[model samples]
Target: MALGLKIVLTFCLSFSTLFPKPIVCLDPGHGTKNARHGCVDEAKVVLAVALELKEQLKQNGFEVVLTHNRLGQDLKAKNPDQDNQKRAQIANRAKAFLFLRIHTDSPSGVSAIYYPQTHPNRPLAQESQKAACLIWRQIKTVLPKTLPQGGVLPESRTKIGAQNGDLLVGSKYSRVPVVTIELVPMSKIGRDWIFQKKNQRLLAQKITQGICDYLYSQH
Candidate 1:
């Protein structure tokens, strides 16, 4: 190699080492069994949003991975236990900077973010809470008029918990910072609005902005 070319390659390698690409793992909640209300399929909608968010993140120079690619597939697991395990494994193996699980709730106009109440990985849980708060604030700012007045919640705040009192399967198993974003209280009117293609795109854009804001703030 020419002397000048070698110097340039060395600098590029050093820069890559100093600032590795950030990998984000996205889990779109539910699958085929999860019922659809009106014209909205919860699984399908979340997956759509996830796909858009993935692209947005990529454009921002972050590496993004989805737990599952399609609507019917459930992370190649036979049961829920295996499903969650597989999801967590994907993030853990990727050494993801963040894990975001997207979900939507019914009876309209509600939105909230959640973090694990307590976990063996306490530091990770704390980080999750911090990210959740940041993302919640951003979402509230963007959808103040449309979503319900909800705040970031810890898993312990709710009575109904996921396996082993974790409140969410992916949250329980994840070793990385993780949060679940639930767009909820979907009243009849809210459902109609959410199913619109334009609205879906807008929602995706807001979420991408929030994630970018959170990541940038950390650095």
Candidate 2:
């Protein structure tokens, strides 16, 4: 009996060592109360994609959490800024290994990924960029022909004077590596593709694959 128990313990330890679980926090950009643009509801689309991504990540052995689960439910905050801060707080509280914000741009024609360019937390900023690059590579692989001109860009890479000096509110406050993925723009073609249920699922799968790759690389 003692010998059998020792063998069981050894096997369990080996299994854990081979497959470490990491927590991932996914934030779907907007809620119903937030801004809306173009034909499809941006909030709904992102949420749908996030939910799908969550499932895919789980299947890949990641523990996933979402900032918000329902439509029209903004973080319990007074304004958009506060709302974003609360979102970051959720991820920070989770101690997530990675945080991804999913959003879409208007007047669509491009897809982009972004990381904080100016944050007080230097380590977090660097990790965020690394995460962004990994995810961007996956996205580019999946949507080679659709990527925008500049591809993955830092927040500060915008036109000099026009830059938003601070990091995105959620990213600035996050304690974990963070990246925001702006899906193809709302251009006619973008709308046509993104609005399709099948394409959204495919996008989620590709994003999840990239995330899994990044996490595994860290190990």
Candidate 3:
């Protein structure tokens, strides 16, 4: 009996070791109250993106979670300056394979943000950089109309960096790989442009495909 119990315990442990959990967290930047480009709100747009990302990731066999739901709560208690502590929590808890914070660019262009390796971030930072590059490349390919600003960058050079905010907040606080993808310029798009429901779905699909490609490449 004792031998059988030992064998059973060992088998369970070995099985767990062989199959590490897969976790992905999504954070939609800003809130519904925050206005973007006078037409659409950051809260609404980002939430849409996050939902789409969750569904797509599910289809690809990932255990996904969202840091912030539609409800409002303090996202930045530990790090008051950056409203991304919620993102950090998700990263810390799940040891997430990827924690993607979705936001929209301003000034009529598209860009992505991640903490550079030269900064406090190191090897984990490199993963984020790679993910950002993959996402940017895929976005550029799918949406030729959107401008390809660049890859993981210092805050100073980025639109988020130029402004006084925590664009790099999640990366700074995150323990696992993290990346922020700026889909498009909400303010730059005119009413005549691609704000239709079909276009939104297309953009979401492109972004989802980009992130999934990055995740698969890692395996």
Candidate 4:
């Protein structure tokens, strides 16, 4: 290589190493086709929350990537397993530091944090849980008491995951710290509060803070 070319390349490499922005992948789970909570589908609400969270994260000096094509685009899948894997692949290919899957649950559901099951062969399970706990703690401090908190839980603890050795497809395939935060239940109280514009922004701010806490702890 030419001497000047090599020097410029070396400088670029060093600069990137010192100032690389951490990449965060946000997967807004479910959509229009998803189960209807009252008048709105699950996807409609989650899309709103994810979009707000994306803006918040960007403002906090992180590069955020959405698995969907558009702001509220819902990716299609022929099968359930494929749908989950496709979402995880987007994060894996981006090599994101964290994969945050956002969703809302039924009336009885609690706002909870779920981490993947520990796997002897997979190194990230433990780290996933560690990150989850930190995010959970941070969120708890900010989220209002009106929203019920379910605390941190292993993936296996959930019903759907329990059938698969406690591992969700996304959780099993993710190469980075993966956590799911179910924001609210479908009940009247949960809906009225979460759907409010101010609350969505507040939720975004809180989630961003939680992510910030986990990222800082890593260093």
Candidate 5:
């Protein structure tokens, strides 16, 4: 009887360990007035992507949180990384498995940001870097190849490029693997092509696929 009980307990523990709770924090960068590009605000584009990503993740059995949803009360914060503290608090409490900051790029095109391996606050785990690379590669594979502007980005030499230096906060305070994806140029194409409703929806779908591939591959 004792032996049977031990075996059953061990089996249950293994099952639980193999299927740990998964949570994701999605942040939409920038706000309305001071967007990276004037055509479509970074806030608007990112929020669109975040909502779609949230839906996709939910379907895949993951809990999702958005740093700035439409119903959010306040968009203004004096802190450099405005919502970094709040994001970190939520992720820590939920024990998030991944943190993704989403934004639409300037007329420059698609790029993803990861904390350099040397960054002081970067998680010391090799697995986190591996996860970042996986997501980066997946996004690179799916974005429109016809556009010369989009591709995986080399790490920034200085953190300042991540927007007023506060950009580093995503990777810095992240307890789990973190990545920020700047998707496509807001103005490179013609006005009709650039702001077409269909194009934005397609972009969101591709991003959701990238995130799903990354997480599923690890399992």
Candidate 6:
């Protein structure tokens, strides 16, 4: 490399390392490998929301990363457990402000937000709940009118985490605050206005509002 080029490259790397940008890692729930057939799958809808969220977050001045960057990501996958762990690892590697997973199918028939019941690091657990509450409030505003409101909850209290004593695989492996937002029951998802472009945009904006609140309030 030319002398001047090397100097510029070195300075850029140092700047990135010394004053790292705040990153938010988004996992767009399950993908094709686990997708439900004949319905608008959770993977497809969540990816759309995440893509919209990524743009909104960037406009608010935060760097964004995705665990499943695209729909094709799960095409060759065989192990769901390994996939979930890798999703958490992506957030850890990014050193994100938080790890937020987006999903549309909620068997519970309510809009719910879940945080780790007992993260190994006490502060992480607290931060996770705080963020979940902030996001949950915003999410409620955009939910279907008929959908019941499920308050921010500890993972252990929910049936979704039954396999792991109330802890989801992603939260179990995460090094930072992890939150999973389940939008609505899959049944409502198909008939509702959720997939409408206008509705999706509004939902993205509300979610962005919550994330910004949690991330910037501290500073």
Give the C-alpha miss distance for residue 25 in model 5, angstroms.
Answer: 1.0
lDDT of 2: 0.74
Query: Which regions in candidate 3 have their CA more than 4 angstroms from the true location?
Result: 1-21, 32-40, 71-82, 113-115, 144-154, 159-167, 188-194
Q: In each prediction, how many residue pairs overlap at the backbone (N, C-alpha, C within less than 3 A)?
A: 10, 3, 1, 1, 0, 1
Q: Which ten residues in a row have the lowest lDDT in candidate 1?
A: 31-40
Q: Determine which window of 10 residues in candidate 3 has minimal summed lDDT.
A: 31-40
Better of 2 and 5 by TM-score: 2
* Cα shift from native, residue 84, model 5 (Å): 2.9
Model 3 C-alpha lDDT per residue in residues 1-219, reported as the tens digit of each score: 245334433443353356764577887876623222222566676777677767755654567788777845555444443455556777779888788877767646555555435435577767877777766665565443545555555545664445534346556677877777666666455222335555556656565565665655665
Q: Candidate 2, TM-score vs. the true structure?
A: 0.83
lDDT of 5: 0.56
Which of candidates 1 and 5 reaches a greater lDDT?
A: 1
**Candidate 4, 1-219: lDDT as tens digits:** 346334433443344367787888998775523221323456777788889999877766678898773433345655566677878999999999899998776788788889986644355887788778877775676566777879999888777688877887778778888998888776777888788989888778767767776666665
Off by over 4 Å in 4: 1-17, 32-40, 69-76, 120-122
Comparing 1 and 3 on TM-score, the stronger one = 1
lDDT of 5 by residue, 95-202 (tens): 777777766555554455454354454443354566666566645654555544434442353234355344355566666666666666565552234355666556
What is the clash tally of candidate 1?
10
- What shift in Å separates residue 83 of candidate 5 from its native position after superposition? 2.9
Decoy 4 TM-score against native:
0.83
Candidate 2 displacement at residue 141 in angstroms:
2.1
Each prediction's TM-score against the native? 0.81, 0.83, 0.73, 0.83, 0.70, 0.83
**Candidate 5 off by > 4 Å:** 1-20, 32-40, 121-125, 154-167, 190-201, 217-219
Tens-place lDDT per residue, model 1, 65-153, is 88888867645576676677788889999999899988776664357888997877888988888888877765676553755756898
Best by lDDT: 6
Judging by lDDT, tell me the better candidate of 2 and 6: 6
Judging by lDDT, tell me the better candidate of 1 and 6: 6
Name the lDDT of candidate 3: 0.61
